[model samples]
Target: MYHVVIGVDDDVEHALACVQGVTNLPGDAAEKEVTLVHSFTDNPSGASATQIHSVREASEYLEDHGIDYDVNESSGDPAEVIIDFAEEEDADLIVTAGRKRSPAGKALFGSVTQSVILNTDRPVMVTGTARGSE
Candidate 1:
């Protein structure tokens, strides 16, 4: 099975965008597994991946399209947790949503998306934020 780790935050639209990216992956392969990985900087409420609104929305989208998915959650550094989870799962592709930064944003520490791309040896797909999707 081709495995993908989609790292999502609390942004619902960005989560959907990542889901769209997964669906757009080029392959006729029969078995595909999507791992919706969410990392919390700190969770006083002790939340799980499925509890996050974005993950739930993304899960719905995946379900509608007949794709198999699982939820994974971790605490502490978002990028580190995401990278660790991807490695643990032996993910074929790692997907992260665009941070929607302005042109004037910092060139360094571009958030989890940039960190994941730079650190991971596996392929990383940075899905852009939804612009005009209805």
Candidate 2:
């Protein structure tokens, strides 16, 4: 089975887009497994809400397609948390939602998706936000 890790955050629409992209991937869907992951630096309640919402949405889609999956939540930097979880899970692929950010904004605040892609050895799949959606 293929182990796929999907990173999620407070943005439900973006998270759903990630899930949708993975589900629609061209391959043997029945042989793939999904894991929805969310991270928060603090506030367990807020973290829980975000993770739950993302997981619920993803689960609805997975269940409809009879895909096996699980949910994970962590308290730390989002990029680090997601990468660590994927490593621990021995994920074959890491999927994440991308947000529209200007070069200055990305340079100033840094980007979780960029960090994950740069750090991980595994393949990364990013989906969400059309080029002009911002």
Candidate 3:
């Protein structure tokens, strides 16, 4: 049984879709424990009521799936928090939704998915299309 950790943004639908994708994997490779992690940037203004609501919605989705999971709300860089949490939990795999970025943005700010892929020892699965690309 693998411990699956998924990084969730405030978007509940996308987060749930990521969770479903991981859990729906066939055969004995299915995850036994799933953890949903949401990180807020250090900017105080970034932490809004909307984030809490999204966390609640993600929690409810886990319950609906009959899958047990822990919700983590932290303050820091998103990529760092996700990697740290996965390491702390000794997760076998990390799943996350990939945000599409503009050519300029991609050149300026490196993608979090790339960072995690390079830094983590465990497997990382990136879902969704790039920000603008479907």
Candidate 4:
């Protein structure tokens, strides 16, 4: 089985992008084991990852697409949570989304997607774009 970690935020579009990334995986969808992770970057109320709309939407999409998955919720830095979870799971692929940011932009905002892509030894598949043209 191919272990895949998909990191999603509250954004539904971004979550769909991650789902699309999984859809592009080779072989059968049944061969993939997916774990959807969401980090509550600033959850004062403490929420479950399953409560996030994007995560729910992605789960539904995956179900309809014949993919099986599970959800994980965590609290902390988004990038760190994602990276650590991926490592713990020994993921074969990491799926995520990020807005297109220039060197200056990224340096200023510190993109989670950028960090995951750069820090992991596993293959990464990124989907969607802020501009949709980049």
The number of the candidate with the highest lDDT is 4
* Model 2 C-alpha lDDT per residue in residues 1-134, reported as the tens digit of each score: 78899988777687778777777777767888998887766783554633466567777777777778887877789999889999998999999988899999999999999999999999999998423211
Give the candidates in order of lDDT, highest first.
4, 1, 2, 3
Which candidate number has the best TM-score?
A: 4
Model 4 segments more than 4 A misplaced: 129-134
TM-score of each: 0.88, 0.87, 0.78, 0.90
TM-score of model 2 (CA atoms): 0.87
Clashing pairs in 3: 100-130, 100-131
lDDT tens digits by residue: candidate 1, 1-134: 79999998999999999988888787632467899988888788887878899999999988887789989887878889889988988899999997767656746446788889889899998888764553
> Which lDDT tens digits does candidate 4 get at residues 74-103?
988888888999999898988899787789
RMSD in angstroms, all models?
2.2, 3.5, 4.4, 3.1
**Candidate 2 regions with alpha-carbon error over 4 angstroms:** 44-51, 130-134
Which is the winner by TM-score between candidate 1 and candidate 4?
A: 4
What C-alpha lDDT, on a 0 to 100 scale, does residue 22 get in candidate 2? Answer: 75
lDDT of each: 0.85, 0.81, 0.73, 0.85
Task: Write candidate 3's Cα lDDT for 1-134 as tens digits.
Answer: 77888887777666766666665655343346778888876555666533576567656766676667777778777789889999998998898877778989978998777778888999988877222211
